[model samples]
Target: MAMTKKIPDTIKGANTFCPGCGHGVVVRLIAEALEELGHADDAICAVAVGCSCLVNVALGIDKIGCPHGRASACAAGIKRVRPGNLVFSYQGDGDSLSIGLAETVYSAQRNEKFTQIIVNNGVFGMTGGQASPCTLIGQKTTTTVDGRSVNMSGVPLDIMKMFGQIESVAYLARGSVHDAQNILNTKRYIKKAFEAQMAGAGFSCVEILSPCPTNWHMEPVDSMERIAGVVSAYYPIGEIVTGGGLNA
Candidate 1:
């Protein structure tokens, strides 16, 4: 909990995120990392649509709104034009791994010097409870009325593992925010991703397994439990890849 301290000049309004959601937490971690690294004032965030848009409410720095699934591309452009700025993309699983897959892959392949923080809640939180590309097997969403059927929907995309094949990628990790210990670890992973960017190591990314109680049809507490017990199990937390290797 202590990892979050809103930056000075943050928008003076309550965040619109749902109760117990993790998007706020992840955004705060990013803000903390930017401040600690002395880039808070120069940080440029490209936020994608869906629940990701709400993050701007609490973000204090300047930002741009990227078209759905285009946060990575936008961030890449920002970094290219203003190489001194700390640029990062904030996107949801549905946006990053679904509509934005091509851009995300190409950016990593190019080793764009930037950071990405993806909040994978398994469902499309803002646009109805639809199953996202990261949805687990048997996970139910509004679209998956009877739980996810791998035969019909195919397997959940193992993006973190897939990123390991990209030699240009600097760091890749998946962390959940369902509990205190994982929150601390997740913040660390986020910081590492930013540090990688600052070092010009290469493209950096961290996937955060967040809870979506409103869309998942469960209590907030239950959603956290699902992330801790099942979601993380399938995703396999910790650093999946570090410095472009399958280090997990």
Candidate 2:
């Protein structure tokens, strides 16, 4: 018999993300985690504006589009209203770390029982590759043609390090999708965040170091190399917090 398709039901069809972009990989990981955890039908995503918005179409599951940088706030509301549903927010560095910083911080402070996945490509990828809050100090972008200067722009925000300090954060981790091992690890971290949310543990998040080939003006392979090389140096991969919230 021809092998039955094993594609996760959460994945409806082909994605429109740029070739070599890591958003596709991260979306796949989310689907895999939801399917494995038996939350495919119960999952609800609050997608942010930008490239992250496309995830709503790529994943067949129910989702709501939030205002720029408001995905976390929206997801938290959904989770609060429908506590049984598995709720998560998909956002980028520009949305999560920059504009949505207040929402993200207070959500953790309130111990909102939900998961958030932040894709940190270091730039405002969908908006002409502007330097984001997480953009490296010397990384070049449309707004930082001379490479980011500390004097002009403050240091890149280490979101995980900052969020991990919250007393109500149940889980916080950073991972990359640049290699096979790292991809697998990223999936694990994502799954753990979802599990934490399902357990009624407080807020949880996973910041994924993703690649933006088109925005970065690099080939796909070189973009992956940059994630493994330049990106990982500042945003180290690994779990930061395990348990320190309501359930913990």
Candidate 3:
């Protein structure tokens, strides 16, 4: 009998994320995408503070830890200094949309040569579930136990649509990992982002609608369903930008 051998890859480590946390799934999908493109060795990832800061240990890649909301800037610098390597930034909603909004916007505006993966869980999971920029209307968090009110907190920012407005952004997509079909689509979108960057087409971003069971106060399975149902309903999953006439 022949034994099946497990291939050595970047995601060969203990699971560090909470149960039902979507960050691990997103990281695994990204690693698989990197392997599929044969760019794992040449890839440099910048991680931001919050739940995604420990992704370096999870993915075991050439990663650098950046301050809250600065992963895009770090990734931009890395790509500029080492244009030969593939660069990507992994950030959470609080990191990317709240504190790092300026960096994220500027990088996209300038068309930085890198990819950005934004995990939108709608709250600051690492900091006791504070409401974030992507928190949906009527959603409850630690800070907003009565549910988010548009009058008090305003509305969730449409990040994908905002990035789509920038001509420098070559590709932009929003995906979810709540279902098998969505998971497969998310994988495909991530792979496309890698390919686009490798082809030097400019910046690309994939916003993943992730789940936070701990903060949501739901069972793991229930949280997954909520992510698919409630979260996906608010943030529809699909490609928003396709590089226009530019080919990867």
Candidate 4:
């Protein structure tokens, strides 16, 4: 009989993210997936500024820090220079949807051969909880003290739909880590995104609806509930693309 192998010792340390922070969970999932797929050694992760900036410490993977919002461009450059390596980027909502919007859109437009993980925590957790591009309508943040108003702050950007419109994007999906089921689904999406990259299909982006307990001024458990009830309601979870299952 064959024996089930254990996860690598490299991923045993305490994560840097705060309690109820979804980044740590997602990072572990990605790391497990990489190990399972035997790409752990060849994977190169690029982390952007914001909450996800210190991804290197969380995941025992080869990681590089990119500029404030240039994770996608940096990932593209790495992939272009080292086509054999599995390249990915870990970015937060502020990093990817705000300052990094141009790079994200252009990379998808060009079908860059890489995978991007966008953690949409709604608020900027690392920088005083400012309202982010993915912040839900009527949600309150440091910048939106009285709830986000459409008149003041345009509608939240539906990044999945926006990138789905780009012909070059091969795989796009939105998932959440607010619940056990959604967490499983998020892992599935991450695996698919990695597979898409390995198959050289095109760009793949997985948007993860995460929680920021500290920013929300709520306890960890309450923050998770908020993500499930409010966050998921606004940003429904599911896959937007599959690259025609070419990667499978």
Candidate 5:
């Protein structure tokens, strides 16, 4: 596919995600989805720190840089103020599910009229590959060199399953970008979440299981393979909740 031409007008500059990081793909998908949904000009995004922070420069949309894991809260504030605008939060697993957990949960509880995208790349890609809330059992991150044992780290937080039960959440899905087919599916999930927000269906979230080659310390292709195999097996893929316009 000629992604260059597909680059929507919403993208202003280049992103700084590592060479093999999946954040870039997710960013492109967001831009395309917003443009396709006719909300490019009306969209505002709150971006969390970590690798996700790099998206600030890439997306031309009005963006707010939240402290640490406050992206959801920031996005919620924006939606509350400008109820007519389309707002979303771009966050990393570590950033959203950890310190920002309260914001994310409350946003769903209130059924905020906005969208959220969480990149679940297992490790904290931006800060030396530390263990994150989504890091899988037996996974080896810098903080978990001996592998994440069940006793030490418990279990990886299944964001989709955990959040799906929130009655206020109008839509929820988890996808990957390890391959072409999965990439398309992930894009569809993102677009659907955005559509749910546009329809005023309340809070929507799409969790993307992405590869962090630089953090995983593997070849780019090997990291992709890990996502297609191990990571996907652990997190699974597809929509976890259905409501609003989520099922296009």
Candidate 6:
């Protein structure tokens, strides 16, 4: 029998994301992963400030709103206390890679047993299109109106590269949601990240390259194509790590 798509009960209310925003897709994928892992009723989500805050209302699971860039710390505490529950943190580039960089790095250093899903749209979508740590050189944002300059900003951070160096990081992957096939593949990566946590393999994170049509001042379709043509070029897509134990 053919399979039908289903939205887990964890998600409720209108998605409310803009036409081409990838947050909605990422949220749905996370919900599906939790349900598939039988964590629908047992998952705790720590959401950071920014657009990620919406996940609390969108996903019916127990959720805690963490201070900006502090979701990782919050998730770590929740996981320790709830040890038996599935714990994950949802954050955006601005919140996770910029303001929350320290929290993120140390959590991996300690091998926190939880999943961290970062939406890397490169721009600060919630606070106008400002350049974020993941914003590419030559990319234009409100702060970098002309274009990002390496001399001034250094370089776009390759978070996976940093996490890959940490001994505690059991799984690290980058995925995109620009097309149907990639979306499905991203879901696979997300699921594996969760599975790694369940196996007690340590810190796991899935960084998803998403599109921001509204912020990019492009039509929705154009934004999707841009992600295919430009964004993915720097970020790339694939499982960078799958834990030493879980093959592929």
Superposed by TM-score, candidate 2 places the C-alpha of residue 119 at a distance from the truth, in angstroms, of 0.5
Candidate closest to the true structure, highest lDDT: 2
In candidate 3, which residue ranges exceed 4 Å CA deviation?
A: 1-8, 245-248
lDDT tens digits by residue: candidate 1, 45-140: 999999999977878888899999999999999999998888999999999999999999888888888888899999898988899998888888
TM-score of each: 0.93, 0.97, 0.95, 0.94, 0.94, 0.96
| Per-residue lDDT value at 107 in model 4 | 90
Off by over 4 Å in 5: 1-4, 244-248
Q: lDDT of candidate 2 vs native? A: 0.92
Q: What is the lDDT of residue 226 in candidate 4?
A: 89
Q: Best candidate per TM-score, number? A: 2
Models, CA RMSD each: 3.0, 1.6, 1.9, 2.1, 2.4, 1.7
- Worst 10-residue lDDT window for candidate 4 reads 239-248
Given candidate 1, what's the lDDT at residue 61?
Answer: 84
Model 1 bad stretches (over 4 Å): 1-13, 244-248
**Candidate 5 per-residue C-alpha lDDT over 1-248 given as tens digits, one digit per residue, 9 for 90 to 100:** 55554569877777888999999999998888888888899999999999999998889999988999899999999999998898999999999999898898888888888888999998888889999998889888999999999999899888777677776688899988889998898889988888788788889999998889998999989999998888888898998877743233
Worst 10 residues of 6 by lDDT: 239-248
lDDT of each: 0.86, 0.92, 0.88, 0.87, 0.88, 0.88
Candidate 4 Cα deviation (angstroms), residue 104: 0.5
Ten residues in a row with the worst lDDT in model 5? Answer: 239-248
Query: How well does candidate 6 match the true structure in TM-score terms?
Result: 0.96
Model 6 over residues 1-248: C-alpha lDDT tens digits? 99996768888968877777889989998888888989889999999898889887788899999999999999999998888899999999999999999999999888788889999989898898899998888888899988899998989998998998876578889999999999999999999888888888788999999998978889888988988987888888999887643332
In model 2, which runs have C-alpha deviations exceeding 4 angstroms?
1-5
Candidate 4 error regions (>4 Å): 1-5, 10-12, 245-248
Residue 67 shift from truth in candidate 6, angstroms: 0.3
